[model samples]
Structures are given as C-alpha cells and as structure tokens.
Target: MSFQGEQHPGVQAPTADSEGFRLNHTMLRIKDPEKALAFYTRVFGMRVLRRLDFEEMQFSLYFLARPEPGERIPEETGERTVWTFSQRGVLELTHNWGTEEQQDFAYHDGNAEPQGFGHICFSVPDLEAAQAWFDANNVTFVKRADQGKMKDVVFVKDADGYWIEVVQADRLGQMGD
Candidate 1:
C-alpha cells in the first residue's frame, strides 16, 4: 500500500483535539496602569510578567500573573530564567495617556453608593484573613456596615476608588446553591 501526504479513514490528525482553550487574561481600561499594577501586586500578589509600550498611540500594555516563588520561565528569545511568566490567569492593563476623562469615574460620591460598575473581584483562599489584611492596610470598605447582598464578600476600594471584591474560593462554589 502506498500513501501520499494523507491519513487512513477514521484516523485523527496529530493536531486534532490536542489543545484546549485557556483564559489568557481579562483586559480593562485603567486611568493609570502603573498605579493599578502596583495595587494588584501589593494586594493580590500578582507579578508583572511583561509590558509593552506604544509611544505613537500614547498607550501601554501590562500583563500580570500569579506564579510560584522562584518559578523559572522561558524568555521570548528562548532563553530560560527563573523570573516567571504570565500563565494561568492574567490581568491586562491598558493605560491611555494625556488628559483624558474617565467616563467610568464620573458617577461616584464618597461612600454614598456604588453606582455603575460595582467592583472587580479577586478570589482568595480565606475570606476573613483577606478582609483582615485589607483592614490592616487601612483600606476602607464601602458600606462596610451595610454589605447588602454582598455581605460575605468584603469590598475594598483602591486609591482610584475601584472596589475590589475578596471572596472565598469555596464560597464561589455555593453560588448555584
């Protein structure tokens, strides 16, 4: 039997069903990428995997990741190092330069209420422990006394007034309960 760049019937190709879809990252507009990146690093322990600068457009791209301590990673040039790379879940930050008004920040009055986009959540292992960390850091929670439906999930506002939701990973399992 002769074959010419072909496979027999019922045979699957090497690339068939090889890889699955992975959530690369969630991109969000940030008034200040540096500030937001700092907050994420300080609060959530996320590290800056890489960053891109677009001088012509006056914008930047920052990719963050959560990696194990001293984790090694392959550089884009194929060089290996223990600096870690963006994997698992990533947070992409886009910073637009110049004097630009943030349409999202317009509707807010100190603790009056949470209007428009309420908050951005980050999953944590321990809810109480995470809440305590926020408290120790002097991060005020909006309507802390009255959490409403988000009682179990503690809310803390970053310097830019963006609410951060710290909820237990297991609690997320009870969502459909």
Candidate 2:
C-alpha cells in the first residue's frame, strides 16, 4: 500500500504546461485579524508578506510566510504583491468587517463532528524545544508529543481554535505503523 513510487488509479501525471504551477497559499477566515496576526507572527515566526483590503466588501486579506535566512523581500508594494503570490506555501488570513465586535461570532474549526477541513502543520528542527515554547506561551494543546498513542507529534490550537499540528521531519521517518 505504499504510495511512494506507484501512482494511484485515476491519477494523471503532470503535463508540461503545468510545470510551473505551484501552490501559492491557503486561505483561512479569521474573526479578528489582530489576534490572529499576533498568534501567527509571535508563535509561528511568520512575517506578513502582503496585505490587501477590500473596502466595498468590508474585508481584508493578510498574506504571510516564513522567509529564509537572509531572504530579501521586495519593498515596493507592486513587486511585493507579485513576489507574495509567486512564493510557495504562503498563508492568507481573511478578515470580515465587524466579526470581532460580535460577541458570539466564531468560525467552524473543522475538527468537530462532521468535520471537513483538517489542520495545518509546521515542521520544526527541535521538537522538544518547540513543545516547550508552546507550553511557555500557554498554548492549548489537543495532544502533546508524549501523551497520545501517536508519539512525537503535537497538536496545538490557535487563537481562533483552529488546530495546528507540529512535527519534526526527522522523527516522522522513525515512526512505525
């Protein structure tokens, strides 16, 4: 059942025309952009690469990514926007106007019953240090690395209760079924 080399049925190979296609970003709706931005930037070390506002629609989008060491981000807005969209693995947070002011407003985290979308993951160099950092930050943990049957993987919740899975790439290959 290993899918490493074998292609699954009904899957088509990439065509030459799609060679440059890349996943630019994943968008998530947030009730409060300020809180969300703080959590992501402080906890995850992601930088706001670009931001766009739709005044008529009463919503704003914030694009974020973890830049490499010594990476140069374009200073000009036009160039930055283009660079932001061209990069792979970006996170986009969409904030609707007035949701933060609503007392009972909440977005479905997709981890409850009838779940659809799942969590996003981050790979860390040192899993133990990351776990300790999350603990120091008072992060709400769905499961600690040592708690569950599936060891060496941690899940923590964000300000909006969306699940975020944390893992170490080297440890992942050491796991057994």
Candidate 3:
C-alpha cells in the first residue's frame, strides 16, 4: 500500500497516532554548535541529519542521528525541523545567538562541584573501544571504575565540561531487559 507522507519508496507513512503522540527530539543549548557537533560526531559516531539556520532569530540548530550499519538519511530541512535516524532516540542541538543564560546555571553556583548536573550517556558497542576513544581524545572523567557489581561504567566530561556516562549497551540491556 502506498503511504501519503512516506517519502521513501517502500516505507509506510506515519499514522494519525504517530502524528499526535510522538517523541520527536530533545533540544539542548550548548556553548558552541560547531564544537558540540564535532564532539558528538567524533566521540559517539553520530551524523548530522539536518541543520537549520534562523537568520531572524540569529540561531542555528542541528539534528543528529546514529544510523544503522549502512543506512542513509533522507534529505529534509525546514524551519522548526526534526531529524530522525535508525536509532533508539534523538539528539537535538540548539545554538541561540548571544548568551541566553544557562538553564542549569544555578547548578554551577554555590555548589561544591556541580555534582547534580549528572552526565550525558552513550551506550557503546565495546567498552574498551569507547574507553580508548575517550582516552585518545583527552576527555576528562569524574569517575572510572575498573569493574564493579554494576557493569563497566565510566563517567566522562564533554567539551563544555558536562559530565557524560559511558557504558556497554549490551551489558546494560542484560541487566534491565
């Protein structure tokens, strides 16, 4: 059956429920969009699915995805756009012109070490490969456990010094799923 909004030849269009009730993407402000793009792509193997620049608003946004082994992304970009890939979730990068004030600004103030901000996590196919990449890239870590009761988990920081947690995807799934 042919689908209305399915740009791809054989894919099915999103149904009505898919239109209304959908988890599209998550937007987060970063210090620099270009730097953030490099970090996410180089460290986690994500690709830029789409990018938009709002001249009036003086803002730039990037939608990224972790595609499968050999899948290609569709070419689509529009104002207030979204990017999707063959992955479990989405990551949105928003760059607003001027210092708009940090949403978690208070987390860095009056706190001994900004411990509450937690970390951004990416499940790696291999823990060793992930660790090596982090090491080679000189990404600092809040904590590193050789091996504990929990699966191999390492806490690292991103370009803006935001904490990021790295763990094996399969190991985590085995514990929960």
Candidate 4:
C-alpha cells in the first residue's frame, strides 16, 4: 500500500480516524434545471431523490443518485429529502432560476484559463459497451479511452461543458459479477 518507494521524507500513512467518514456528494451548477435533469437521469440512469426550491434565493437544487434495484424512493417529501442525504455518491445539481432565459448563459466549467475544477467520474460495468453507447447517442468526447495515452479511461463533456471521467470497473482489474 505504500507509494512504491517514491515516498516523500515527511509523508506518513493515514491514521485510522478517517475510517468513520464517507463521501456524501459532489455539487455542480447547471444553467437549466430541466435539461440538466434529463441528461443525468436518462444518460446515467440516476433518479431524483428530492428537489428543494429556494424561491427567495432564486435557485433550485436537485439531488440525484443511481438507485439500487429494489430500493424504493420514499413517497413523502420529508422522508424523501432525508433519504437523499443518506446515500453516498450523490450528485447535486443547482439551477439558478433565470439562467435558462439567458441565451448566452454558461457556468464556469473550471477548465478554462484560471482552471479550478476538472471533472467528475463514473464507473461503468463494461467499457466498450459504454463507449459505443456514448458514440451512438452522440455524446461529446473529450478523450476516448483508446485514443489517449491513458488507454482505458474515457472523458466526456456534460451539458454544462463539465468534463466527466468514465472508467470501466473491469478495465481497472475489477470485473463485474
């Protein structure tokens, strides 16, 4: 588990205290709520667990997750909202109310000159099938797994121009059951 003998002088292994935590979610801002929702749900098969609209702040939040096969989303608003926060790997898309009307509206994808955020990632069960699906559907490709030096990683752009890294679990040496 060590860094293969390239360790820095002051580096040390992580302590056990980090074991209690898990990543809950990552947030991204979108120009149009409907478009963004459709892209995530239809393309990735994620579902909207809950949506919270902040009228006073002129914005709305949509929480989505790839639901388990037999897991049902709750019927009540309160219960559903709570359930939304309980899952890991949640994607929160925020829509500023009026951006849809602005013809030139675009959120900083963080890949331009003063680059900040790069991309988010998703693991697919089959790399070749996933790549073919993206191609047949005309999804924008920043880099195809076979074209780049990385050889087994795919990068596509979301509706908002945000890069999304698509990796196949099998390609990572973890074949699906």
Best of the candidates, TM-score: 2
Model 3, 1-177: lDDT tens digits are 764563657877567776646565666667666667888899878887777789999898777767788765555554224335333457777777654355543213111354454555677778888788888987776666475555578877666666667878666656642
After superposition, candidate 1 runs with Cα above 4 Å error: 1-19, 75-86, 99-119, 143-146
Task: Please provide, for model 1 over 70-119, each residue's C-alpha lDDT reduced to its tens digit, 9 standing for 90 to 100.
Answer: 87655663242123232556777677774246555532423455445556
Candidate 4 lDDT by residue in tens digits, 41-98? 8788888888899999998899999988998888999998888887899999998888
Clashing pairs in 1: 72-82
* Candidate 4: residue pairs that collide: none
Considering TM-score, which of the candidate structures 1 and 4 is the better prediction for this target? Answer: 4
For model 4, the run of ten residues with the poorest summed lDDT: 168-177
- Report every candidate's CA lDDT: 0.67, 0.93, 0.67, 0.87
RMSD of each: 9.7, 2.6, 9.0, 4.3
The lDDT of model 1 is 0.67
Query: How far does residue 156 in candidate 4 sit from its true spot (Å)?
Result: 0.4
Candidate ranking under TM-score, highest first, comes to: 2, 4, 3, 1
Ranking by lDDT: 2, 4, 3, 1
The 10-residue segment of model 1 with minimum total lDDT is: 77-86
TM-score (all chains, Cα) for each model: 0.65, 0.94, 0.67, 0.86
Which residue ranges in model 2 land beyond 4 Å of their true spot?
Answer: 1-6
Residue pairs with backbone atoms closer than 3 Å in model 3 (clashes): none
Candidate 3 lDDT score at position 3: 41
